[model samples]
Target chain A: MSWVNWILVICMYPFVLIMYFCLKNEGHDPKKRVYYGVSLSKEQAEDQIVTEIGNAYKKQMKRLLWISFLTSVPVLILPSFSIAFTYWCFWFLFVCFVFFWPFGIANKKLREVKLEKGWTTGEAQPRYTEIKEAAGIRKVKWYHFLGPVVISIACVVWAVLQPRDGREAMLIILAATFGGMTLMFAALAFWMDKEKTAIVSSDSNVNVNYARARKNMWKNFWVAFAWFNTLYTVGILFYQVQESEVTGMFWLLLGLYILFTVILLVWVIQKSKALEERYADKMDLKVEEGDDAHWLWGMLYCNPKDKHTMVNKRVGLGTTINLATPVGKGVAVFLILTLLSMPVLGIWLILDDFTPIQLKVEENCLVAKHVTEKYRVPFEDVREAQLLTKLPNIGRNYGTSMDNVKKGNYRLRDESISCEVLLNPENGLFIRLETEDEIYLFSGFDDTETRQVYEAMIK
Target chain B: MVIILQDGSEVPVFKQIRNQIVMGISDGRLQPGEKLPTVRALAEEIGINSMTVNKAYQLLKQEGYIMTDRRNGVRVRESFRMTPELPLESKEQLKQLVSEARVRGVSQEEFMALVEEYFSAGQRE
Candidate 1:
């Protein structure tokens, strides 16, 4: 497990590097960043303002790249799972220092440059017609949603038919993720339709260029997300955990997912950057208008009057919540709560593996209790009871189990019956009972205690 | 082909849509029998209500600027010809315009030249 953590860290460093580059490269587009769509006048262009700005940006990027590389080296020394708390704190602080602080500084520098060069425009004069036409085209067609819809439906059918108890939780989570993404994509498409493009270009060609670029970026994003979700669902559906490779394949799949997501994000960022560079000249022109006050801390949008809860980032390919609005605040709170709950859930899962399971005899019935699930059997329903020293080598056909804690339905090898099993594998003291309808199997983690219970049951 | 709606304008939204389409037609930007976007599509494109676009389409249909059918949807009329006789409303409007020009002390020649300039501007667009 520690090695797994270390491997993850090592693998993620490149992703962090790419993210750093993207942030450092922010505001490289003077059209969108400085003039806010109003291109610089010919005089402004020849003033060497653009050149000075470029030099300043390049210097900052170079310095930040070095710092990023140096800071990331600490991961090599941090062992997986050891000092987990400290490691996580360091990770959090490192991210903020590298990304957040640098972003703010760079944004401020760009603003200063804009002021110095008199590049900031008075009003945004975007070609509204071209923008409207582009927005109309950017909508997600009916067919774009087909993949996720079909996948979710198939997941439901698979869950009902297969009924793998242990994997049921995993399957349901996958289904919800895909289904939720479908809804999100639809919502985002509509939101984008109403987005006020802030570029102030009179050049219809430049407006079209920007619009088409945005459209392509969104299209690629949705397509990639849909494909990734479908592939993950398919993987989970057909995945069989072999006895020889306990948890190995599962971990492998998780690692692959992380790498795939990182690659997708990098590709999107690089593509967006390329498009900006390619269209920068065409979009650069006389300054007209912009909304410099809409952003807070160079990242968060703080528009009190804006009705939008989520908006596209000025410099990137993601949506940021406008923290100024009530709805946005609610969304922010929800996100924070979700983030905080993850570690708590992890702790709960870890504790579940250690909790003792209690099985006791009652006046007229038997009771079994684990941490969460409980079971009971009336004496009247018991047809036969037997204690065995050895049990068959059974696999968890469908249900959850740790090293010793096992519960739920299972298939016994070389047997036709699908028995209801609730047992800890450590006990090796098997309690088999035959009811009128079927057989039930139970085991205990402690062999001595389990044997005594079995004897008492027989008596 | 661009419809710019002024929020504080005296004209309503539907009228704006109707006027733009009519202007587009007269300027030859919209060819004879050219297909227009469906009412729903136009409404969504402009971020306006469907009823507004519907009103505009209905007006265009009534004025003979556009025609609609079950299969073809909305389109510019196949042939456009100026009416030989001006409607009473249009005549009244012309009279008011002439009276305003007279009051402004503009010569008939100057007024005719201004009209020619305005009409040619539309053609150029």
Candidate 2:
């Protein structure tokens, strides 16, 4: 690499660090406290504390950004010297170190906030809500993944196609790909933040924003950093092994680097485990007192008459409809398809040929001929129905299914039906009517109840 | 009776619910026979945890201020009554208020005369 290229890379380090801290510290803000029809003034002790923490976080972020910009100035000038490469690399590493410094400080401040005020204190309460708000609309708004996916593909193709002098190019391409992947991973983290239930436990004493952002940033950084380092190390190894002219000193340096990286990774993993254990120990699981009737309160589409409706505790679906388990079935389908294609594709690649897997609907069933001998009932046969009792492992143990049914666990009255059928140990057909349209075929039912239910449903 | 829960108020939500219910009962705005909203309804209305509303109701029941029947749901206790006796300090404060009024150029005769006039007018209406 030219001196200018090295300088440019060094110059970008502080900016990257600043960006990291900015993203990490983004969620720390005091939420406006509300009590009995009145807005509590920030003058209140708890509110004041929250304000101070938020202000401190903001100030720290500002300072970190300023320092990053200042550090970047030296790299822009492109220092002309014999040790320019070393100087540029060291400066780049320093910038990366500084980028995470604010996050470390913020983490400490969060610990302080947790200690000084009780974990469930007002200042700590609002952090999660604030972070959720800051995360913006839930879906992955940033098209970060596309760039990484493209770059990764390009790097792989280039490495395969190019015969000689491609090692250095591959290393640079792989590094850029890693960077792009980091951005994509960060976007995914934000997306997960949106989808996951914002359950800020009442007993959590620390500011949620401080805790959540810290946890998320640390998680994202280390995961990305580790993966990047691993890939870079592999790339370097590949280059050294492939090239005939690599020096003995380079091999020595690579060995030491690998050893140091492994040690650091181990330490991080141990620290993370300890932190998780500590949190688990401190967390209290309290059963909040309330009638089950109150559970439906403030819920969307909840009517007084809908009190008896049996809702899925897992999927949050009401008894009246079968909502697609969000992202579950789709992901399952993708995985199944991928698994089936892998062997075929691998073999085809060796033969330098390909054949597309065909899906066919036979007798109202989706049959996969080229893959597993599995078939799915057509959509028309699928009924949206609720079980009379909570399916085993579905409902709260404290509540009896019979009592709920007696109290009126209204099930969906859909026309379409699907049954899950299975064979028993005695070779009897054990058919489970899953929906109105489809029957799942399986084996090992304890009794004849499964056959009886299936017979009743089909009849 | 409408009860407003201030989300930003320093008081906890349950306490707010309890205090409002108490105030409503004492002021006779909530009648003895009247049914209060279910815990779920109340919580939904106030945008608070239903458990908090349940807590308030539980407290009210323990205080003999409300009754809950599974069939009829929650209602004000039929025999619920606030103690009529004024505290000694309050009685003393009343005496002080009368004395202050007397000092401020109002006599007992004038106060009685005004009271009689109001009563006579009410009777005529």
Candidate 3:
């Protein structure tokens, strides 16, 4: 047997074991039960049933994430292995990873908490009751894996049986596989959209409004698609340059892809901007006197404002907590780091270096250091606070950041002071109270304000 | 005006709706004859099952807090007033308990004496 077959067999072993474990652990596990509003001894049987269900969910998620990740590994390594092997593994991995990542993480987190706290604990109670009810069982749909498995098997067989020694056959097979996958994805997305509409009655005005928002979002998907295409076109250009054997046909396709991408991106941006402006105007019109409308557009855009506000009230807390902005800043930093690291490590193999970093704010201190990054700051020495504000400038030099700054359009407003006090533990920090205007800077952080605004957040 | 659902609360959705409407009435939020959203419309707006809203409306109607007419939709009951009275069954039960107390060598005067003593004790702090 060839090395390809050996590798395939090794990969298949884990897949079979994972599937079996998931299937065996399909129902609730008694060990993970939660006893609430009753004596443990009296509710032991019911608790057992609940625990079993929770454990099954945990196992199912573990299986899904592991299988998805394993599948993705080969696919991600495909481009590098393409010359040595007939199939592309990277694309397969990419699709599986994206499809399962969110569900996997949510399930894993739930399971971890359940195991740590045990079944009888209130905190370990299954929080996904609604989701489970909606999804029915915590098992993968047979149809989900059917298309990919068939394609994978067909590729393996074709690679082994095909008589051609040239790369053309391999290229054709890869293209065909990708094309088929794309068609399947499009069909799936269409079906999901249809299902959403079906679940909510069409006559309901709220449903109608939600549907309109969804439609608007669907239109916005083109923005993401355009960006992807633009990036893909750039990758193809790089490939053509590196491998100088490209024909006229490749150039034609590349040119078409770039044109379509640019046009769609411009259209998406213009439409999105128009929609946003209109939305803001509508919201402004709806505001009434004495209404406790604490939400602004930015808050609504980033988080589900209604849900968060209700959650805050339920916890007997005010909606004054602004953890969203800090979380958003960390996410922005992550994205920047990932984008920066792309060239150094080939995008496909970048996951090997993936590590999570946490930045925490304590009662008296704030820390903005990553787990992987070399820089570390412990709030103690951070004595200075500055606010860098910028204004938009139109006309002569529209595109340059330097020109915009040089035009004195950017000025630091020193009228009101705001500052953050950092603490040791880094989960809860303090802000010195100054004035209403100064507190506006901390509005995004959690509607709270300080006497001196930090320079780090000004931009 | 819209009432938002409290997802994290232990309070049932129907109870939340009922309480909000009651508060609205007491605070003059809903005028005497102002038509409220139909059960279906309210349910849709709140993103909850229509049955939940219907249940709240049914409770409100039974309590004389709101009145629903086929032609006019639902509205705050005109000339509604809250009255404090013990239920017939509860009053009967209380009488039985007092009779039992009398059987145990406790007279009406003695019971009154105990009540006064308990009240005075409660007020002392």
CAPRI grade, predicted model 2 = incorrect
Query: Of 1 and 3, which scores higher on DockQ?
Result: 1
- Candidate DockQ values, in order, are 0.10, 0.02, 0.01
Tens digit per residue, CA lDDT, model 1, A90-143: 563455455656455555655676677667654433213322342345545667
Best by DockQ: 1
Runs of candidate 3 exceeding 4 Å displacement: A1-169, A176-259, A276-281, A285-341, A344-459, B6-14, B18-125
Better of 2 and 3 by TM-score: 3
lDDT of 2 by residue, A1-459 (tens): 344434345435434643554344232312312111112233432555545755665676677667666655544454332233334445545554554454445444544544465543343121111111222323333453444445455555555564443233444555455545555555444434433222223332332432454345344444545355445545643553342333344434444444554454445445544543445444332111111112221121222321222221211111111122333344446655755554454343322211222333456543322222244455356553222222221111111112111111112213222222212223333332355433343322223454444333443
- Which consecutive 10 residues in model 1 chain A have the weakest lDDT in total? A125-134
Give all candidates' CA lDDT scores: 0.64, 0.43, 0.39
Candidates 1 and 3: which is better by TM-score? 1
> How many residue pairs collide in each prediction?
9, 45, 31
Candidate 3 docking class: incorrect
**Candidate 3 residue lDDT tens string, A1-459:** 234423433443444443334223322222222121111232443445545644655565666556654654453354333221222233223332332333334334444443454633433121111110121111223353444445444444544464432333433454344434434444433333322221122122333343355444543453345234334433443342232333334435534554554455445445544543444323311111111122221121123222221111100001122224554445456655765453344432232222222233444443332222222233444443333232211111111111001110111223312222211111123322233222211111211222132433322
lDDT of 3 by residue, B7-38 (tens): 55687878878877775665554567767777
Per-prediction TM-score: 0.64, 0.25, 0.27
Ranking by TM-score: 1, 3, 2
